[model samples]
Target: MNVRTEIIAGITTFLTMAYILAVNPNIMGDIGMDKGAIFTTTAIISMFSTLIMALYARLPFALAPGMGLNAFFAYTVCTKMGYDWSFALTAVLIEGVAFIILTETNLRDAIVNAIPASIRNAIGPGIGLYIAFIGLKNGGVIASSSATFVTLGTITSGPGLLSIIGLVLTGTLLILNVRGALLLGILGTTLIGLPMGLTTFGGVAGLPPSIAPIAFKFDFTHVFTVDMLIVVLTFLFIDMFDTIGTLVGVSTKAGMLRNGQVPHLKRAFMADAVGTTIGSMMGSSAIATYVESASGVAQGGRSGLTAFTTAVCFAVALIFAPLFLSIPGSATCPVLVIVGLFMLSPIRDIDLDDYSESLPAFICLVLMPLTYSISDGILIGIISYVVLNLLGGKRRKLTPTMYVLVVLFILKYVFIG
Candidate 1:
């Protein structure tokens, strides 16, 4: 591998995903986690985990706290479930351990195949809508309403106006095929927010914040609770599929797949699993392989050196905590909206003519944004898929795992909910 090409590819991948530095802290901070500590933890976890991926998996992929998973940790588990961040962290830890076991036993693929393709495909778009809704709300583009339960916010000025401008600029950059469109969009929007008093200026470089406040703060008291089971399962479900999808997709783009199988796939999964397990101890969300690594692969990254370079970049980013933490919600909101758009691309694969599949997929997609919960969307979608298929005389489409999941989901709604 060419060293310089690998370095450039690594940087390209890091730029595409670096927005997580700003976005994760914002999401977790809302639930009373220390943003400064989270910033440090995020960087540390990303750096080390990606380094592990490079050394062990020998792949040009990066790892970090995932987007939708973080949202679920903060909003669904902590905010709605009335659990604290520690409880969510414990759940993540458990999920990581379970992931490790599944990977070792070679059960990961079986579980992945067990989930219906329609439901699996619906998840990304559902989360996209949910994330976009959050962005709109954060930027003041959408507001809670008394009459209709939701309405448009004032867009002529303030955060809403800034978000609109950022959206246009970022959209333009994306249209032009900019490599770091998301990160550049965040920075550009933050600069625009300076005059509107939405962005605050902090020093660009400094010692990284201490992670002591949030690190190793997991709560195990509720580990046996039903809610904890649901939370852990949800974390595993999302992380498992997302990591697999990223590894396959990026490897395909890089021509690293050998006869439809990803070489070193087990090692890649282990890297993600180990990172997530340790990242919880560092007080971060579930870490996974990033789909954005496709950017680096597209840049001709063919070896672990590219991932190593990206890890080095994350390590360097630790010193810029203040700058990243100072980015206002409005500035990062546009990226979320754009990412939401990116996530929706999978919807094209859903066959709309078959109501047995399409109706459940539609339910899964719509309920995520409307209910503001990813787990609920997945659970209910599975339930609907199973029931509709059973009723429609399409019983062959149902898997044994689907039946078990549908039963558990029904029990959750009937008793716990």
Candidate 2:
């Protein structure tokens, strides 16, 4: 591979995804994790995990703690479930170990195939809406109402006004096909927020914070509880499908798929599995392959060198902890809203003409944002899909695994959830 081109491609990919550096810390910090420590851990995990992808998988893909999964860890598991962040970390660790086993045994596909295509397709968009809602709330664009349950915030001032301005600016950049649109938007918003007293400017560069307080802080006391099982399974399901989707989509774009099959697929899965496992120990969420790697592939990245270059970039980013940590939720929240738009693209692929499929998919998509729980969306989606299809006389379309999932979900609601 041409070194210059590969380096450029790698930088391109990193810029497209580097917003995660600020956003993940903000999300996890909500649950009382040290933002500085999370920032360091995020960079470290991203650097090494992506290194694994480069050397072991020999692919031009990058890994980082994922977006929606982090939200679930902070909001659903910790805040909503009333569990500590350590409990969520332990669940992530278990999920990673389970993912490694599944990948090694080649049983990942079996589990993937068992889920209905409609429900599978719905998960991403469901999470998109959920994340977008969080962005709006965080940015003061949405507010809770005592009478109506929710209402519009004062969009003309404060964080709300700033977010609206950022949204338009960022949307314009996206329309112009700007590289690093999200990162640039965050910086621009932070700058704008300065006069409004919304963004605080800390010193730009500093030594990375110590991760000692959060690292290896997993709580395994609840490992045998049903709640832990649900959390772990949710983590596995989202990461597994999301990684596979990214690999397939990016590889297809890069012409790396032979006969509609991704070469070195197992190795790629292993890299993601290992990343998640290691990331938990570093006190982060489930690490997964980023679909933004498509930007690098589109830049003609074709070998492991591109990923290696990206890993090096993350390593360098550790020194900028102060700059990244200073970014306010108002600045990063707009990126979340935009990412939600990106994730919603898959909804176009769903066959809306079929009620049996579309109805459950619609339920899955809506429940995530409304219920504020990704796991609940998936669980209820599967249950409705099975019940509707079976009663609608389309029993042949139901898989044995789907049936099993429905029963388990029902028991979860009845017993634990």
Candidate 3:
């Protein structure tokens, strides 16, 4: 890549990925997370994810602790189900490691191959809905209620209006294929909010003047416990498949993958797995490839430089974490809706050859929004695949891993419930 072009690509990449660094920790904290650990972990994991993409994968991509999974870690695991942060974070770490192994073993490919195309189509929309829900929840636009909806912060407030404006502006930029659209949208909105008193401290995300936050006390010896391993194993698969889907979609956008081959797939995946492993040690949530950056990459990014720029930006943003907190959640909402739109682009190509594939794909597409859970949507889609396969009289079509997923699904229900 030309140096100038690389710089531009890197800048764009940074803008696209930076939001997660400032946002994920807060979202994760909503589930009983100790503030110190959440901030430290979120920052460090984002670094690892970016570095892996730049160095190992050498692809112009980025990764992080997925937004949806982190919320579940907080609300479902730590709060509702009563698991400790240790268990939840440990689970994230486990999932990451498992993702690594799965990518290495080619088993991940086997599972992806097993899914019917219809369900595959559904994954994008499912994920889009999941992401949109996350945005709303974080923005305080939606609150949980008994068989009903609740609103926390209303759009009528000044803060709410600024946020909504930011979202609209961000979404517009994305649609226009503007460079550094995310950064511009956020920065512009935050600046705009200052005059209106929507921003607390001039709308900049900055580190506290005192010492930056740190993580929980380390227990290095326990890193190898059976529980840790199991957690890592599960996340590994989840993150692995998730990234694959993203890579496939993004590669298609960039014309990087022609036919069945995506050049540098192995390298890209390796970087992500290594990033995940690095994340756990840093006291953060699991790290995995972020497909959303594809929007930036698709626009013209073409080298690891793009990802490296993103990582550097994340580190810079961490120094301003406190200011980052001041930006109203509503401002970020538009980006979420916009991203939801971008992610939805892949749904057009899903194969609807038979009900077996079509049914699961459609179900997966709808369930992400309805269940309000990405993992749940994926699990449901997987289970549906197996059932549809058997029902269609193609029992052999179910892979061994699919069977394992079925068994694990049952256990997850019995145990998690």
The alpha-carbon deviation from the true structure for residue 199 of candidate 2, after best TM-score superposition, in angstroms, is 1.2
By summed lDDT, the worst window of 10 consecutive residues in model 2 runs over 341-350
Clashing pairs in 2: none
Segments in model 1 whose C-alpha atoms lie over 4 Å from true places: none
Best by TM-score: 2
The order of the candidates by lDDT, greatest first, is 2, 1, 3
Give the TM-scores of the predictions, in the order they appear. Answer: 0.98, 0.99, 0.82
TM-score of 2: 0.99
How far residue 61's Cα lies from its native spot in candidate 1, in Å, is 0.5
Candidate 2, residue 385: lDDT: 96
- Compose the digit string of candidate 1's lDDT tens values, residues 227-293: 8988998899889878987888778777898989998999999999999999999999999899999
TM-score of 3: 0.82
lDDT of 2 by residue, 289-327 (tens): 999999999998988899999999999999999899889
Clashes of each: 0, 0, 22
Model 3 segments more than 4 A misplaced: 34-43, 114-117, 143-153, 158-162, 192-198, 202-234, 257-260, 295-300, 392-396, 411-416
